[model samples]
Target: MTLTEKQERALCVLDDLIDEGIDVTNLRQEIHLSNTYSYDAVRTRLRRAFGSVENALRAYGLYDQTAEPERLELERCFYIDQDYRVSENRYKSEELKELYGISEIKFQQYKKVLLENLEREALDIYVRDTFPYGLKRDYIYKHKLWHVEKYLRNFYGHSVRKLCEEWDFSYELFNDSYSSFYITQGHIFEGLVGEVLDAIYPGRVESQRRIENCIPDFIVNGRHWIDAKLSEKTAFNRASKTFSKYLKHTENLTIIYAQKSDGVYSFPNVTLVHISRYIPELIKIHRSDLIEKINAFLSNLKINIENVS
Candidate 1:
């Protein structure tokens, strides 16, 4: 895909910032401040075009770097100070202060430095165990590692891009996985919808039956088209336009959304329904065992699907 001129400019700015050793966790604000684009605009454009700001930086051959000595220092400090093993002891800050015979202010400063190194050490161990050869940025986000990302940024002042660089990983090889993750997730949700539909309309549900240029997710009773979306309706306008082509084949089109929206989405010959609401109701009566499967799927996605009533 070719990037627009503005997107190209944003990538250039991001390239310069990474070279200057800027922390990119707050990349949207950084890019917005560096250019005429608003924060939301920059964020939306980058995400729409590059999947993420990190991926945009990767597109420009930019990745974060940390000095080898700094990592070694963190590891040394963590190992040398046995008391820094706060996770095992579960000591309160006050208890630690008293044990060390220090004022609260001094204890706070001491704890800050200790935890910084400790977090880095823990993160390193986690990366080594979980990703052996290299950490995949898309895997982190897909698995909902927000806490890990936040901890690394807040305590270690490092981003996933930095870890990738440190591990000698190539972003070019895995950056595309960011977009593919969403596509995979969407396909999973679509399959879940198809299963639910199969239980409801048994033997009447057809999968990905093509009609002209459009291939809807499912066709029920050889008439209605069912399309499962794993995102909010506000983000479905592009898909909706494409689905409009299916109207020529079938007047009935059901758009099932995995995520709930506050307002109803409207389109010609299309009926919008949330998966959480519609699927559970059908599954409760048609196939209760599917509840376990649905919940397991949601748990893996780190999301909640309402129980069947």
Candidate 2:
């Protein structure tokens, strides 16, 4: 029951607020700013503070019971952050003047669009932080393993030479050929799978090391062996037969085909999956239960509030 990063951050903010004598239950009405700032800046500061508290409350399910007037005011204040600000060019555009002509309708439309974008951006950030399975892509969202070596370097905090030393290896191998690229691609795909699995089912994914003989890419829950195939042609390759033999004794095994191709293929008596399909499915499931998950996350934080009233 690990607290999500958002919950941890929100808890810290709540602790600060409570330490400052701000009432958590009546956050919007009770928060008070110092007289040091100008009137406008003070108002802005108060709004920003209230917005943060409102976010924390919402994360904890406390804000769901907020009064209508307070909730609406908090929502308005929440949008004042720099991320919600329109670009200067957009502000000066002729379309802006036309939009302003129909102020009431345009305001509602603009708010909707802005809030939707903000929510999407926040979700994306959270997903990345929660499951940093690295995949490079072009303008379109396609899994490209171009950043494989880079990710490995960063994740392991070592270069190839350093890795060899850390692992107590005597020799090192290097080649810029397709074979080397293929190996790196395989590692990247397996890493992505491991990250996603770990996010959904934390502390269950364990990557197979280079020295591990006859091991699959990952072992989930110490039972299911997950093999990542980055190349479509690998299915037909003789090496795949050897891989199959390694996992033959295992009761449950899954093959993750992580190539960029579109079509699907089935394997004999084996679970076959494509990365493109796999990632989106996991994202959909996560999004479907996101609110309940966040609430669970808050409960895990164990924030002791002595003075909510």
Candidate 3:
């Protein structure tokens, strides 16, 4: 059960980074490894180290506490590093793909591994109230993609470019890789909204359709245009800037956002009634009453219809 020199080194670096609240995306660049360590090499060493630890714990009847080796590795590799750019919910970084030989099939396997042994209660504690921070505690209580919430807060708290500079990663490259993750989140948000709409009026929701030069997210009853905005506060300014292009003066458009923010959005010359609310509210009432409320809400917005036809 003796730890390999590389395993010991990786763990040491990992602990240091966690203590410092440093993001672990560019660990290889941030810390110098005596030996050349590729993504695969580090992963292999971590796996072996985890097995060693688990075996030692088992010798003392503590194996059950350490039964989740794969999950433990993810906590060390992803959570401890606090790197939200790529995690279970996001697309893996290219370097990670190359390091782990992750194909489409392997990606699913990797996801399965990280998802095992995760407890929502622990994650709730980690986010709702500050507990003594430790990877061991996070592993015991991780909510799915807790890192994303952390990253959003970090990115909003300061300039993303400046933070990326600290890690020697290109901000543009990081954003590009992260756009997929962002888009995936958007899709999930939109899907929830769509379900609510469909329940009200079946077969009336048109999605991802191009009208004129703009493709709107949803068109209800061949008249009402709706766009769902589900973004962190950090991306609000950027998202607001692009709102005008899709929303014309003549378009019957309404925008619904997931979160309420004290920050104001600078809308274009166009006048529109945009509501800041989430799906939970929409799903709270009886289906018949919910439908009436949704229609009433959209009607109150007084959207202007564009003659795209």
Candidate 4:
């Protein structure tokens, strides 16, 4: 696509900002503050020209493979923020997919790359901040070593013991600050589930009900415990352990999962329900407008569970 005159101007401003090491996360704001262009006018023109601000950045070489980690993170965060803005009813799922060039697998791969880069950056910062005098083997302690071991095994396919020998960083002090840095899909899904429950049951729904060491996502009618999970059935074993604790407090437990499954899962005192199924059914009966929000949230996750029966 040929760049419009406004887009060309915007790109020039962006280039100057990048050269000056100014933050471009708020691209519209920066553009407006830098020039006579109205903020909304620039945003609208850019969207009309490039579909999204992120796409414009990509076309302008800001998302190049050799881009600095800071630049990449800023670009990705802007992309994600734009996605959330549109997903909250500015556009439908199909429109979002078309505009963002997103598919389920592709989005997942993009997130994996983003997360890996963030983890590497976090690790570097942690080491630099904690060990200003350089790391020594004798100064390390092995507290919660298994947690770091499992994290490395899952995310990096590296063995922690070998990694410690190779990298000279304490497993105990290497905090995975990803959760602290970003709002994860799990947290968003749980919040969506709470919204749906509140819309349907109103005054009868209680959120994050604590029962001893366990806290289910919600309790409906003060009897039925509900948990919202973002994973597919592969999380059954882990969820089962938590559900077992929930069942002791309630007669039945319900799990509202985001991903689709092949068959209905069976568990003692538990019912497995896909969010697609549960939300649509309630919307059919209650006629709640929150269905659109739920659909949009699922679309952002690139999870097409809308067709599940």
Candidate 5:
């Protein structure tokens, strides 16, 4: 670990080649042109190993390279990558395309120079006594549905890291048995099944995590999961027998009950479906029962009968 301490030995082999998936443009070509040293001395030792920890393990990536105990997973990525959003830049998107805007004493002298640069960076003395909780713009959409464990990614992962962003020592191996619909209609049931279950399962539903063991409310497609209950009627009969231990992982569950008397009841292999009976012709009867199981697996694949000759 010491070619004159080559920036903490290339940040511990660039965090074990970014947990062995490698690809920060092949990790700057395997730390500068695969080893005979001197791609300008491995880019001056990876620019002083991302300038002495400002890269923080390439901004925190290497999460559990598949130890896979009790499904605690993590591989965070947030790439929108290309968007200068081509506009009249040079701030205020070029003062709204060079019409020279923002009067009212130049918007109170640019909000008094951004509160005097957050009171000379003490950030108002570390936000005075910090009263922040929930909805600070919803912690960027629950950390983008917890690094995309969307279709409920078999519920609860990031298996161990006692402290990444505060709490992550999570593990819940099995639980499944589902039926639920207890909404008073919020965001019109996520604007008609949340953009058609993230356009039919792009990495499976995760409305974020929380587990006293299962029912992390909202999942679909990557083998359908859901647990939403708005309460009352003796707390929806003790939360429908407490998600009957989510039938040990997956029974393609749902339990959406918003019945203030009338309409919406769909029960297939389980029962009680009503966010007003999950409308739009009961959500096209689940894409016409998955096009009748892909037309009964192409009518039992008769192998086109050509061999009958």
Candidate 6:
């Protein structure tokens, strides 16, 4: 299909940004409207320009900028781009009247759209026609995915923010209309990890409850615990450190770093499960070893927890 002139321009700029690894938002700011793009206009132009705004950005080709510097910029662009933030929440419908205040419902609605858009972007690569929204991948590893392991539901920023509050995390919520924006489907990542853990242990795990000192990801069999980290090396290191710190005080704790890293990396005791290799590889595993490995994982994790406690 041919693109409109404006969309062609948008595509040109998009390809340039993707190739340059330049911030699409920054590029959009500098090239599209000369610092005049409002959130709504930007949203409109982005939707008009690309079939999948997130996918186009993921096609961002070569980021030749300074490695670390460019990465930070990518984070700002990929996660913070105003273009990807364009979707509206479905919960905006009036049915939420008695369930929450207008303000609260609006927050959840926005959260839903943001997560949906992000997932749409990430899931765009897996299948041509059957990208399931919030659908759990029954098997573990996904060789096709770029960043996530599975899709999850029933989570949003409000939940994470609530947990942050419980942990005294001091993370601040940005006013939608005012803040520059940091776009991460963090809630979805948390939710999916919680869901997968539940599947793995079946009835042994439940979504985590927010409590200052409580684990923020999952409660397995009402005892085992997980702190989910989106699959990135830095995220792994950070989560590993957090787990290390956690070991100084808690018992029966396990930090699960779900990543596309090395195809679903599961560090035996550390529990770093590579989502890429996880399910496929596990499917081929000898049932005995798989169970034994899972048991060993819990055991070593318990050892880590003992140290933390």
lDDT of 1 at 298: 67
Every model's TM-score: 0.39, 0.32, 0.31, 0.39, 0.22, 0.28
Q: Tell me, by TM-score, which candidate is best.
A: 4
RMSD of 5: 22.1
- Count steric clashes of candidate 5: 29
lDDT of every model, 2 decimals: 0.57, 0.45, 0.45, 0.55, 0.36, 0.41
Q: What are the runs in model 4 whose C-alpha is more than 4 Å off?
A: 1-183, 234-237, 261-265, 280-288, 303-309
Task: Give the poorly placed runs of model 6, Cα more than 4 Å off.
Answer: 1-184, 210-212, 234-241, 249-253, 257-269, 277-309
Measured on C-alpha atoms, candidate 2 has an lDDT of 0.45
lDDT of 6 at 48: 70
For model 3, how does the per-residue alpha-carbon lDDT over 23-70 read when each residue is reduced to its tens digit?
Answer: 234445643442333445544555576654334223222213312334
Query: What tens-digit string does per-residue lDDT give for candidate 1 at 140-180?
Result: 57866655666557743655665556554334434455534
- Pairs that collide in candidate 4 are none
Alpha-carbon deviation at 161 in model 2, angstroms: 28
lDDT of 5 by residue, 145-165 (tens): 332222112222321221112
Clash number by candidate, in order: 0, 0, 7, 0, 29, 20
Lowest summed lDDT across 10 adjacent residues in model 1 is found at 77-86
Ten residues in a row with the worst lDDT in model 6?
Answer: 125-134
Candidate 6 on 1-309: residue-level lDDT in tens? Answer: 455777667666554433443345344454443343344454465677665555434333222212222222212223312222223324432333223223322333344445654554433222111222212233223433323343322223324344334333324332332111212334444554554555456677766464332234676665555666544442443344455544544465655543344534333245544433344444554334444444454455436434533
Question: Considering only N, C-alpha and C atoms within 3 Å, which residue pairs clash in candidate 3?
Answer: 122-141, 123-141, 250-305, 250-306, 251-304, 251-306, 252-305
Residue range 254-281, candidate 4, lDDT tens digits: 8888766566567788887778776666
Best by lDDT: 1
Relative to the true structure, candidate 5 reaches a TM of 0.22
In model 6, how large is the Cα lDDT of residue 217?
63
In the order shown, the candidates' Cα RMSDs to the true structure are 24.4, 23.6, 17.7, 21.7, 22.1, 21.0
